[model samples]
Target: MRQDRKSLAWSTLLEIDSQPEGPLHRKLCGALRSAVVAGRVTPGSALPPSRVLAEDLGCSRWVITEAYAQLIAEGYLEARSGSATRVRATAAVPNQGQPRSNPQISVPVEFEMLPGMPDLRTFPRKRWADAVREVTASIASADLGYPDVFGHPRLRERLAAYLVRGRGAAVSADDVIVCDGTLDGVVRLCRALRSAGHTHVAVEDPGWSRLSSAVSTVGLTPVPVEVDRDGLRIDRLRANTLTRAVIVAPAHQFPTGTVLTPARRAELLHWAREVDGLVMEDDYDAEFRYDRRPIGTVQGMDSARVVLMGSLSKTLSPALRIGWVVAPPRWAEALREAAVAVTPPPVIDQLAFAAFLDAGWYDGHIRASRLRYRSRRDLLLKEMASTLPDLEISGAAAGFHLLLHLNDCDAAQAVRRAARLGLRLVDLDQYRMSARTGPPALVLGYGNLSDASVPEAVRRLAEAVRGKGTGTSCG
Candidate 1:
């Protein structure tokens, strides 16, 4: 019996008793059949018990039983002893003049160069499962109730220590606030800014759209600040007097992968201090640097002016939804107040993550992931150099993605044609807030791409670029 629909109080079913034209059982049967045929009652839906329906419809139990039996004989319903009666799986009629067809399930592309996705195959399932099991077995009864508005204390302490030790951020456990992920942290920060009388937030011109969207969602306008080889142009940001707060990925900027130069970093902090503004540092994928040692965070230098945001989305898995915000002392209270409005991630998961960190599993996982991704990046660079030598590539020094500058080539058209060739690619223009003109480019991500698929994927990409064929192949 489908418990969900067993107590269904369908008006049509109850209305049969008011029908004065035919016998009670016959009327009930006709109404039920019409309901099923008309799609009022969905297929596989449980009908009410005979006694319940009889009492509700003011009819004898035998009448309800007789109608149910008749429907079963007509192949409109099914019944088993000791179970509730249910509509036949195929009893519902199709719409007039329409033929039934199987539901469509979308097939994924064989080779996807989607930016910001980590390879899911490497997730430490056993370790994570063990941590969860251990935490569940040993967690205190009091910890199972409502979570702390800021975060679980143990997780916050672990995150604070980890961030300071790894990312070089200056923060204590009191400054840490756990969030669902980077985007959730962004939203909470935006709301806090709005509450603090902020009207505009400066964002990177060609930046992650979802983060900018989060800014706009909180009723604060996102001012686009151009990013260059040195990272966010400090002079361009200084020009916008109305915008005080800015979000930046200093360790490795997205799309371009340019690290924020020390000079620009100093200038950014200066600007923040001058205006008493905040700098939201999105330290995403900072741990995966391949060419050199990852730069220490801006918050490490000036913790008072910066809010360091990081998460396990890249280092571990997005499914965990574990992220933290190291807020400045001035904004910590406001962010905590904003945190109350959003439901924090599960406390058990938080504790499990703390256990993972405390056990040094997180560090081990990051080291292994860095090696794996670096190999993939090297393979992709080599293939591109061998096949598409004429095409210029940038941002290959670090991170899961790199930029393929399509000089004079139409990136949008290339993406469309690539789709026809069973290749997935993203255009750089999609990330731009303004219609700035430059050589078009594609943001190619090789994180989730398998090593065995690299040669064929690059070959297909070459075909798409060369306008060779229109036929689609997943080879």
Candidate 2:
């Protein structure tokens, strides 16, 4: 009889209609919360295990696990050792709040050259699947329980070693705090810094626009520092005494791919030391350098003053939403506390990643991706040389994207012209931190472009430039 009641309660969840747009786990959570409030599932009644409930609901176990974890965090559910999870006694239905507005604006895209994307076509599905299977089969019971708010212990240890050897980050497992992605890490870091009395944070001008948004969201001002030929200007940073924390993509500056010269790197550290400030390094796309070996990260120079953040978005799939922050001893606790205040990422995914890194599959995947990106970059440069000689290309040293300087030509007009010609591209103006004007430049991403399509795309862009009175020909 109790079994029937349990089935009926689970069936009510299945009947709950969720919006098709947002995450299914969120909808499941809503359904479960409503059931608890409506007195259908009384307090002290046991809920089915995540695996069994998922099977009955025709969903993934992780989905069910995540929903349960969220409810547990909200005080709607409670789990006891060696016992089933139970509905907690509560008079108030926790406010789930309204869903956030979707930011995606639908637009026509033909030849996609937008930056900050990796080749999704070549994702190593077989290896990832095998790793997931191995992890699930052998995972300890303790892992299936609530995960450490900091991170999965084994994954943290594995990531520490990997970052040290691969990226030259001086870190230990204790210092690593896993996050959903680089943006998530930064948001949490911003809040922690704000709590510690940082009012203004410095960002690179003509930088990733999302950085500014994140900073502002945490009630901190994002001061735009200029990026010169070498990298971020230390002179500007020094002048801005109010700004104590700065975010940098030192390995490869976004939009414009310039490395932070050794001298500037030293200056940045010195500035941080003098000001008793912090440097948040976004090591995005540092693994795929073409011409030479990649440079060491800024965090290796002075780990105490620098916090290193990185993710597999470039190396693997961004959809995975896995990243980590290795902070200094002083800042690690605050960052971890901030991370714990939010929903922790799934434990199973973290364990699978640990297994993947432990087996060296991550290294192999990076090598394969590097080769493909290098070939595409070479083909792009070759095509541009023959078809569009007037445009100056820069940032070819590392990363998947390159910058094309369109001197005097209106970048916005050229972009529209390219779109009309069935090619999609973005200009540097879109990445500016302020309304301040600078020379027009276009950021062309070759990560997803095919070898056969490179020449045609360049030709169309050249025509767009020629239309602006450049009079350059695609010879």
Candidate 3:
């Protein structure tokens, strides 16, 4: 039985010897031929030079040369001119997920304005790195062992303090459960709600698709209530036969970027109260508002019903991988219970973040980032108006994203063309929970781009909308 190439390659290779009774070269060639036949030398592999093989075997180079010649004649090796002997081409190998040689070419324009990405360059690296090193040094080895299921206590404390001032949310460190991000925090909330007898959750129709996914991830059906400029229609909650929770982006609605009006906020609170339900407020980008005063959170007014979630992913960097779930006092224990054994945010990051806040670096960065994003946003709007004056944009007053309504245009087609041209923007319809029966649109994020990148990116985007190619990733 012939050995396999992989196995034979590992052991002693057969070689011709002295003290030959029959021709040693012939015997060596026979062994080499068998090894090659047994898949030893893999096709197209170069044989060791005769001299090297002869030295190893302590035999004449002729012996090794003759042996290699046998394999070459037996179709195991291809000795082509100007090419090292290589394994013959075979059918596709067993390797999976092998990337094709062809890849998308680099371009100067990108069409996809991907949401949820922060301007990472603005991260206070020196401060954050110093904080990380400090926290890593200060925290005990036990702290590194496993996170306290819910989250780091110090981080929760800092977050509670920060949110109380920034968003008017009343939360103690104990009421906070640190999770991976807003999505995971919402998922944790949904699991808790479902565990407590909820079967359905109300979400804004044309809502953030993620809200629906978060609701559904825990086995509950998503009851997508309608959303208008005022936000989710609270009046329709009673009509929802199964809803016990509502997920909302009150500060700046996703894709639309409209603040939930004060009147609507009150109304929704009333609806949640009436049904003995809950409101999951995703404060996605409330920190970067440019319009009216920062949108006051509904949680500050009524903490018991609102599971307010927020993350620094936009304010700082998502790579830090920290988010908070400020739950009602009643749910804290269970939320922590769920968190205790789950994937907690890394302790070092949490500690580093706590120290970062302690150092007052995050605030400074936020101030700088706010100015930068505002400039980029203004440039985007300016360039869009100059290039495509007829195009409509909404959600401009605040938030990092703008909903671009290319009137009577094909949003997906434009997105595809832009992607081919190397743009990294998303079509507005892509974020919709249900089919958008209205004007086709795209989502433009200006938060990450620089002032210079903004105008050119949007102009190229406008070009893409005009059926011209724009293939660079925006920013």
lDDT of 2 by residue, 1-475 (tens): 1234355547555445853455778878778887777666767777887778888888887567556655664557754433566776542533344234311113345588888789888888988899889989999998898878788889999999999999998999999998887877887788889889999999998788667655654556789888888999999999988998999989999978888999999999999999999999999788988888877899999999999999988889888878999999889988766664565578888988998998899999889888889988988899888877777889846789988888787888787777767778888987776554578888999887877788888888788766645454222
Clashing pairs in 1: none
Error of 2 at 460 (Å): 1.9
Q: Give one digit per residue, the lDDT tens place, for model 1 in 348-392.
A: 999999999999999999898888999999898899899888888
Candidate 2: give the clashing pairs.
Answer: none
The true-versus-predicted C-alpha distance at residue 276 of model 2, in Å, is 0.5
**For residues 338-374, could you state the per-residue lDDT of candidate 3 as single tens digits?**
6643577788988998888888887788778777777
Off by over 4 Å in 3: 1-112, 468-475
Regions of model 2 farther than 4 Å from truth: 1-108, 468-475
Runs of candidate 1 exceeding 4 Å displacement: 1-108, 470-475
**Model 3 clash tally?**
26
Q: Rate the local accuracy (lDDT) of all candidates.
A: 0.82, 0.80, 0.70
What TM-score quantifies how close candidate 1 is to the native fold?
0.77
